[model samples]
Target: MTSLDLALIQDAYAKLRPVVHQTPLFSNRLLSQLTDCDLYLKAENLQITGSFKIRGALNKVSAVAQTNASGVVTGSSGNHGQAVAWAARFMHLTAQIVVPTTAPAAKVEAALSYGAQVEYCGTTSHERLERAQQIAKDTGMTFVPPYDDPLVMAGQGTIGLEILEQRPDVQTVLIPIGGGGLISGIATAIKSLRPDIRVIGVEPLGAPKAYQSRQAHARITLPSTDTIADGLKSLALGTQTYPIIERLVDDLVTVDDDEIRYAMGLLLTRQKLLTEPSGAATTAYALRRPAQIRGQKVVALISGGNIDVPTLCHQLNP
Candidate 1:
């Protein structure tokens, strides 16, 4: 329905095979009992780049590979920084990644280790993008947008493609939304495949652009947000992704930091899964409002595993 199609995603899967790991899926019996749903966890946190962002990063970079340019540039909250840096390295290209001032030191270090030049910008993700774009234009770099690119969304769609095929009767697919790349791509593929399936997007209550956009039935902007889930703190929804979501996504939900922390603790204690706050948004929603999504064959994406190790260790055994 958008610029990207299944063929493009298929090609991306082929290109990504060498670089990205096919993350595993596992049955969550405790989650099932708690939420009264046949819940499956798509362990994207265990993905090769430690998040689903690598899929979009590789697809976007490969789309520009034929241009044979000097380098590419992008801005991110954290996960996308690592993804772009990893992709740039794999493709043998230079990457200039811009991050907001609040981005975690651990994430920035990972990007640097991947050999990308990292820059710190304003306090918000939108401001970082503005800086990144200007640098790309001034330096003749290919501007690799985090979520506003068709290629990026298509790559993220592959997650939905695999989920539907793996769990044929999946009734709901819940994904966390920051800039909307992952949810848009996933909603596009899954809704196209099975119109009856529900596509739910989770956002942090403090960072509610996606929820606002859905409410307005048009693109809505966010001023700023302060949330512990730094990865979900985008000031606006993605441009290219908004259309896909307007057409495909069935519903949206939100969770607060306390809920996220509770979900993270539950996963650590009950499931032994180490998830960042953003990745645990779906579980938070499920736990907070079980009756709404209960008793469904649901697929929830644990979108990243790049937690602060010491922070997680303290939470786990505290």
Candidate 2:
């Protein structure tokens, strides 16, 4: 397992504070009434690059830039790609991002706008990895993994720190899971500091890799992911993130596409938050499965706000 401790996370927080936005955490009255709990939204959709991926990407790039690397390479469904491209630009380093062909256009354009070379791979995590690895090998660029690194996880743990400082009385945190980096980091930080605070993970039912992995006691690669939450469509969990999540996270739950769209619509209309489907999964779980965390001060992480206009219109109207 990776050596992730409180000190390492604190260092990441200190390093990232100047670079990343300390995103807002606010309680929504409408959502609170609906969930019958004191509900707070960690609006990371408002974060730099429109997602929390910046934290980890920035952390990784900073470390790699120290060695004066020729360039940086990474793979993502979208948000992480944008984040890496953004961070690389900020550091004045060349970046090449490999994304699945099915990735959202808005996200792809966002990365391209950062002056990074964007390449299309197949529509799976493994395919993205293969292309990214090949690019890294050919160009002799530093490969920045989207997740599965201690430094990256430590950077993401900063979110947990901010949440606790923002609301010391928070009873529970509902974090969205992709490849498990965000939840693993948050859960580790929360469980280490305030052991009383519960950390729950939310995943789309169509891409329940982490949930299935936990059930089987090993990683389970899905043949395909069939969810509207595109950012959470990892085929399997990383070795580092999986063990940390299994040990630190208190619970795991899933939301369907319908529930995700409902939550997304609610956030957009009621809370005036433009959250992507993956980010909205936590609130979806809260609304669909209330028994698990009712009557608690809950904070749901909004992972990103990169949904396309057409998709948003369809989700909101459908």
Candidate 3:
């Protein structure tokens, strides 16, 4: 297994600087007042492809582009598929993305618009991943493990580097967790640089893979998941991401769908930011427990803004 370290993350940063956006880290007075903390928002929702997943996708695809592989295949709930498709297009390689049958239509369409072949599999990350791997084998394409590869984690870690640069005084960093790639990468970067900073991961209550895994002290898969955050319904954390998160992440917490909905509405109405439920999860955690991080300098990472209009209206109205 390849080790994930600060040096590897830094190298990813250097390589991705020309491509990925250094997303903004801005503070909102209203959110700070609500959480009773000095809060900054890492707006990866405004990132290219409308999420931070592009960072990892570009980095991973670029590496694969150097090889003789004809193309790449992978599975995603939504955002990762779009990112991979976009990255594959940018790198001049073909892509085949296996998405869950229940994945958000907008995200699926976005992937298709990028000229990648799209396949619908069972409505779970594991199921789609199995199908994607089989496709890779049959097509002689490289299988890019969505969140499990070292390169993907290192690429995502570039967000940590940006956060530290954007806010050197940040005391706590809250990131939404899916297969643990985002948190694992950012936590490793933050802990390696400023060990004092707290790195917390927020997951949907219905899909608390990271939280449950931490409790068990080992990686475990859930039989099913239920959440509005389609991008966050992974049944398990990546094998490569789990150990890094276990060692470096400070804590893991979960928020119910209603809370995530509330946070999404608040972000749009008050903060003037549109985020999908998965993106607002960290904010939901902070809003639900203001006293926990009171008086601390907190950075809540908004992971994506790819919700469809119908879902957005329903969530906002609910």
Task: Please give the distance, in angstroms, between residue 265's alpha carbon in candidate 1 and its true position after superposition.
Answer: 1.2
lDDT of 2 at 22: 94
> lDDT score of model 2?
0.90
Better of 1 and 2 by lDDT: 2
RMSD of each: 1.9, 1.1, 0.9
Question: In model 3, which regions exceed 4 Å deviation?
Answer: none
TM-score, every prediction: 0.95, 0.98, 0.98
- Off by more than 4 A, model 2: none
What tens-digit string does per-residue lDDT give for candidate 2 at 103-218?
Answer: 88999999999999999998998999888998899989988888888888888899999999999999989998899888878887888899999988889999999888878988
Whole-model Cα lDDT per candidate? 0.84, 0.90, 0.91
Q: Tell me the TM-score of model 2.
A: 0.98
Sorting all predicted structures by lDDT, with the top scorer first, yields 3, 2, 1
